[model samples]
Target: MTTISQTAGYTDLQTALKVRARNPALDRLRCFLTLVVLLHHSVIAYTYFGHTDPKSWIGFDAIILSTDSFFMATFFFLSGLFIWPSLAHKEPWIFLRDRLLRLGLPLAIAALTIIPIAYYAIALRRAPHISFADFWWTTVTVGPWPSGPVWFISVLLAFDLAASTLHRLSPKLVDPINRLSLRGYERPAVFFVFMLIVTAIVYIPARVYFGASRWFEFGPLSLQSSRVLLYPVYFFIGAGVGAANFDRGLLSADGRLAKSNWAWIIAAMIPYCLLWVLIYMKREILGNPVWLPDWYEIIYGLLFAAFSAAILFAILAYFLRFKRLGSSMLDPMQAAAYGMFLVHDPIVLWLQYWLFDVDMPAIAKALIVFVLTVLLSWGATAALLKIPGATRVL
Candidate 1:
């Protein structure tokens, strides 16, 4: 018979082992990314409420671009990082089932519950005369027109499903992609050139013909198309990194490579920030429609994206190096961040409509909305996590 204290000690040790198995750095990254998403949505809310002109709001515009494209790219990459190992370790059917339960269920819930609320709110505010049936029909058949942020969930589910199918058919295909490397003197330059060409080819045509809005549209029940070909690239990159055991050397305190990695990150940001400023100036000065020439947008967009990715990875690397900061109370908030992402837009829209008549500066109104939305969204997610089905998807 084991003593009670001994059993308690064994349980504690088991818990510690379980946590050590998972990546704390990834948890921190998730938390930071959630804040990025929050900031992005806050700025968009400000724009929606006519607090600032879309053209002139340089900081806000930069945040929007970085958040919309870069963060999602990173998310996919991180997802891919974890996914390949899990897939390689588990049976195919089990992996598929888990993906469906995790990705598919959330998507179904978003479409059925969250999106309908968005449409209802919009209809009430913008077109009150429209019946609920009309709103429902439009959302179901046409879309919530401009779909909410949860659009990422649906799109990612598609990617996962596709990747899983391919993996099942040809597990060998991923092996080569997983093995791609930059071994030569000019490899980094070659990689950059390849990325540039790919970005131009994908984004240029899409921007020139389809327009920016159309490129990101969520077509009813069929596809969520976008000019962002780099999402798949990021996912595969994550998979490759996992396959190669690419740990963040700089993230460790005693690591020798820290300084060089930090320098690379900072150097990357200079071009990114400059590109953002240039794009902001062009948009503000020219007052051109959002759908401008693909060439310029593609070039600048890629530059900004590279910068964003570098900065994000660097920040994570640095934080991971200093273990003291990793144990913050805010860590759980990161886990709750995805849930907040799914729900924040509807909350923002409702709050904006409710406060439309309030006498306040546009910035003040925006701040209020941001604070309230973050609190409410975080709380909603926290509560949902306690419920079994909600946690299953969330």
Candidate 2:
């Protein structure tokens, strides 16, 4: 008995629901995080200890310290959101197909192309006579092949495949987490505690054993040895939150999280300062030992986990508070964020390489490089997206 008009109306409602499901706040946050990624890379060549350039900046160390701590974890968490819904909406094969195209394609391309180009700039510094072609060939064939920032894409693809398998086996496996998320709508602190505890449990022991600087790599596939489990913990937590009632769940803009973002920010700073204390302990007390003791790593890992968890909450709470206010400035760059992430490494490195001998303060060089990188990366992404059907993948 359904009339054609009624059917069309129902379909429109479905479309509207789909639109509503996309969280603009998180989109803007992700875009902002992409810029943070840029800043992290842009400033590293200028940091005091890693002063490859003639000039070095102390302030960049503080910037690097903060960004290196929380940005990747935040990326994983943001990525995990909407995955469950993606699984729920698509067939297993379709989900895999889309993920491979979206995540895997870019990863494969970046590994062979973008990453090599980025690192070649560094290779030029080490051996000014080395050609990019030779450097890239040796890197890929012999050893120390790096994936660079695209490691996230590969890891994300793995998480996506795992999620699809879990969805097939039992969609309800995450039901308990979904339940917890419902409670989180009213008290986001509960979710914050959950995230902190889980990350700490997974991160501390591994960090103590492997050390923070240790990375496990085979070819272009690489990740921090200490954080293998930590990333997935955040992803699954995000999955659980998005399993049902997204707006009514943990990230609810109208909920307690947004209402009291200042508290979460305060919570974030305590552990952040604690991390600096541990740094001081390492340098001043331990005399910058070549090898840190297990006790030191354990304490450092605890502070790292706590700071990461708190900052995740703080960032989300701030965004949720502004979610419905109006059009975000980030909207323009949102589509370009992924492209910016994929392509920025080479841009920053090449810029830094060009600025290597420039007679300027470290801060000035960093500012110039950072600004140009942002502009060029954004322009490159915008141009690429204009190609025939490029939007389908990049």
Candidate 3:
């Protein structure tokens, strides 16, 4: 039987042949995750900090946290999984070039077009006196403005650069990591323990000291960091798993693997739901604690991370089981996922401004903005992708 890699236009002949199926299930998973991200950011825009009334209650803040983290974690993991097969066979320069086109170009476009537009909307809402010239100057020439979700691209690039450096310095490191990952696949318990330990060791100090800021002032280096250590660890884990062909049964449909995946997913949700409730209670009753202890943050964060991974993987596995489900209509929406990531912030910001004067409940206003942003983002992305060169990365 011909494998996926043998399919025309499916495999890169120039790269090492790591034969894996395209798995439409995974593509659908990506599309769903992107929507989750859109929802999370849309909620953020309509919440108090952006434009919603301070007393307004959106009922979505709690759900947003889990969705954002899980969506991003899955995105990074999938990215890492794709990387190893490409890097293992391709020349280093070629690999870097492809990454640059895919990640860097989108970032540049976001910074110039999407981010500035979002800032303009924000300025109009918060300070109507601000002129177009001033807003453009502030967004473009000034300091690092929060470019909404495009921050993920910057962080991912940083991680990729670090990985590249390691590869350059210690060429033998990749082989050993791959071997270790293969061994861990055989012993799932050990792999889980290692992941937990690594999460604690790397995340604890970073979170406590860094305080969740993306841009850190570390002398000349000016460390652009976010998610502390969580993202890099997940990215590397993905690469390792890909290299070693460690399936984790996430794509498997039959027998023990399927059963185990479902069981673990349900088990994982217990802790996730509990932690979320605890967090809500702590905020509501105890009042926001001024300083969270390192131990508490580490434990809670690690638990959330694990639960998020389990939930996402299980969902993917279950969906993959139904082969006919992949026949759904493909739209420009699939191509627009990246563009939406870039453009949605502006769309949301603008929508929030327009909805500000409307006398509606917070939940109602949020829903309105959410729907509007989705439509606007979809439209904008479609238009952007039609332009020359823009379609390449987005």
Give the TM-score of each candidate: 0.78, 0.94, 0.81
Give the RMSD in angstroms, all C-alphas superposed, for model 3.
Answer: 6.4
lDDT of 3: 0.59
Candidate 1 residue lDDT tens string, 1-394: 0000001111111122211255565566666666666666555645522343222243554556546545666676666655555655667787678667765676677767786776586578668788877887777776645445655665566666776776678665555444332221123333334444554565455545655455444453322244456566666655554443334322333333233456646756786777757666666875756656666666665565556456545554455554545486557675576677777777777777776677666567667777888899899989888997665556
Cα lDDT tens digits for candidate 3, 335-382: 666666667777777777777777777778777877887788789878
Worst 10 residues of 3 by lDDT: 1-10
Which pairs of residues collide in candidate 2? none
Residue range 133-220, candidate 2, lDDT tens digits: 8998999999689777777777778888898999889988788888898899898888888878889999999988887777878898
Error of 3 at 173 (Å): 4.1
Ordered from best to worst TM-score, the candidate numbers read 2, 3, 1
Which number leads on lDDT? 2
Prediction RMSDs, each to the true structure: 8.6, 7.6, 6.4
Candidate 1 residue runs with Cα over 4 Å from true position:
1-20, 48-58, 129-134, 141-146, 169-209, 216-228, 244-265, 284-291, 322-326
Which structure among the candidates has the greatest TM-score? Answer: 2
Clashing pairs in 1: 251-321
What lDDT would candidate 1 get against the real structure? 0.56
